[model samples]
Target: MRQSLRSPQQHCPARRQPLPVRNRVHRAWPVAGVAALAVITAGAFTTLAGLLVGPLHREFGWSRSTIGLASSVNMVLYGLTAPFAAALMDRFGMRRVVGTALALVAFGALWTTVMTAPWQFVLAWGVLVGAGCGSMALAFAATVTQRWFVRRRGLVTGVLTAAGVFGQFAFLPLLSRVVERFAWRTAALTLVVAVTVVLPLVLLLLRDHPADVGVRAYGAGEFTARPASAPGAARRTVRALLRSARTGPFWLLAATFAICGASTNGVMWTHFTPAAHDHGMPATVASSLLAMIGVFNVVGAVASGRLTDRFDPRRLLAAYFALRGLTLLALPLLMTATAGPPMVTFVVLFGLLDVATVPPTLALCRELYGGDSAIVFGWVGAAHQLGAGIAAFAGGAARDAFGSYDPLWVGVGALCGAGALLALTVVRPSRT
Candidate 1:
């Protein structure tokens, strides 16, 4: 039998080879890495309010309700602004959108220093800071996770979401010390400086897409195409809302997130320090407890992300909400003048639940909505903020009316129970 010596060119056409992880022109992790740091800096404005509210009340002779109204406005704007921020990021690029947001945060923090009246506080903290921070909200984490990593989306989401925990945990003690030692103005100045510093970093390192650095998303075998530029952001937002409103899952997710925001940002982050004060704890000690929660939250959030990659997200969310509810029910008992085992245990448990909801929630959004995940999550985030804003105001009002945060805690715990039931009801799509 004649062995036919075919020319080498007669072989089947070469298959496209994936670029090696090391030899790839650009990597996704660097972009995600920079984003994580920028996110931490962006969050500086959020945690200080609990510490500042008391000082502002004392210095300006304002009511707790009045101070809380400003925080409410901030939360509302933070939620309301997210869809547009997502839109802006889609159309204009991440660097420009985030850069502009940082500028707004700096201006607001700086402007807050000279505020002499309640209305000025509203304008600076409520309007400016709210809008600025909202523009850089958790949607950024979702956006980056979806765009940068195919293999570790859940884990990355967890880490990025933990950035918020880092901001609150790492900074609250320091900010409380600053407020106690100097004027509240000094604390505001610190926020301005921090945001200003992050601005240069965003410009220098952040890119809108992996292609901008010449590589595919991590684990993907090829480059993905850029999405079409968004239409008028306001118009797109309205349209997306209208379309998403027709779905049951959208409402379910939104409702659950609202509870999340109400429980965490609205009630706890905004009032926990003062509530602890009611039980005889000093501001420093209260802030330390909150900071400790943040530390554990980092662990919980990261772990949740890895879990989300492996388990049913809906189940994880249900368990997280139920656990959080139990913790909230126990919180009042632990509120004491001196730090003790009970309080320490509460901090650890609650911190693990804090922001751990984010990874599973985002994973579900991405799985369900595909390309629209960022915007859908943005609207859901709006619900979260709305709940947070309302809770902030309502908690203050409740405290004023009853002279205790007991009612607020009980009410939020009930809401968490409802959220757990809702999370379990979500119609999960089969994982591919």
Candidate 2:
């Protein structure tokens, strides 16, 4: 078995220590750089998809089902790759993996500018973007949690995740306006430029660990023994996480996170525009509302991040699911384009729980999996994407079938209730 890191709050060997113990602090630059890259990349791809949805639909005459499938493919792959990517990071290093992933994203985005058919678009933009992002997704999140100061792990995760939501919120609208002003192809090319611009800064600023620079982990009172793996090579870190699968608490965490995915990005992100359109809301207006969802998602995610350090992650997850379900169920009753109580009520409540589960879910992964926490969380993240894939496609398919998203709204609400049960009853101290 691979060796675990030194126990929490432990210090490194004497010769390896950077400066006097008192001078060691987790440098902020590397993690900040990673977070910045995450925000821009996630924001760019999500916005690009939104802007292209109209153009692709108009150009190809493909049904919404066809378009939704592409996103589903992308999301599933994105989540599935996370564990492997984390494994790879453990082997190689973040600098190479992240840089390569960014390059792939850039290649995929630019390649889409030349596609003449829907499948071509799917393969290039959907698959490649998913692949690129898959390698980059929760790897960054894991690194932030593992490498940052312990007391601030929750806060760090929240802030980093918020960068992703902000990307969705801010960039989609900006790109929407850009697509309005320019062709969709031009809008896509712009993203390629943006990713390329960020790559250099990442290479220059990011180091996989503080130890590389002759320092202990950020705020770690003690450090663990380093593993024997090469500085940068991909391995089956996911297999490491499977050890926890035999237990109940891990299952509870997986199930709850799957619901987390289904409830938020799976349904809300995928179906919001079409659902709003069902009620006669224009697509762009619906998009703005979704972007608004990103805003509150940022808030909820940040708050949850702070909360994870103090509260039982299970309680936080259970509460998030209960609240999310209630809000989703209320949507058919509450949502509208106009500025009114039901609409505002829907926005405020649902938005609060949008991404609130992330911190607690991640914290619980560490609790349950211990030394293999990063890899375990990667698999859990994979479960989230799988739920996202199914729900994303299902939401679109439901819209295509029944002409509204009411059934999915109800179904997701029910799943959330199930998730709450799993969180409250199944989660135990050693199980995580």
Residue 37 displacement (Å), model 2: 3.0
| Clashing residue pairs, backbone N/CA/C < 3 A, model 1 | none
Tens-place lDDT per residue, model 1, 1-432, is 233455333563342234354466346777887788777876678887888788988889999999999999999998888888887888898889888888998898888898899999999999998998888888888888777889988888888888866886688888889999987889889888887677888899898988777778889988888777776877877787888889899999999999999999999889999999999899999999988988898999999999999999999999999999999998887787999998898889999999999999998888778787888899999999999999999999999999999989988998999999999999977766
Residue 347, candidate 1: alpha-carbon lDDT: 88
Worst 10 residues of 2 by lDDT: 1-10
lDDT of 2 by residue, 1-432 (tens): 123455332554665565666454356546665656755575568555645656677887888778888888888888877887787777777778888888888888888888877788779877888888877776567765686456677887887777776676666666766777778888888788888778888788777776666656656777645556554333456356658788777777878888888887688777776677667776677667777877887788889998888888888888888888888887887656553667766877877787788888888778777767887887888788889889988987887898778999999999999998888875556443
Question: Candidate 1 at residue 287, lDDT?
Answer: 90
TM-score of each prediction: 0.93, 0.88
For each candidate, the alpha-carbon lDDT, in order, equals: 0.88, 0.75
Worst 10 residues of 1 by lDDT: 12-21
Best by lDDT: 1
Judged by lDDT against the true structure, how good is candidate 2? 0.75
Stretches > 4 Å off in candidate 1: 1-26, 430-432
Candidate 2 — which residues are off by over 4 angstroms? Answer: 1-26, 222-227, 230-235, 430-432
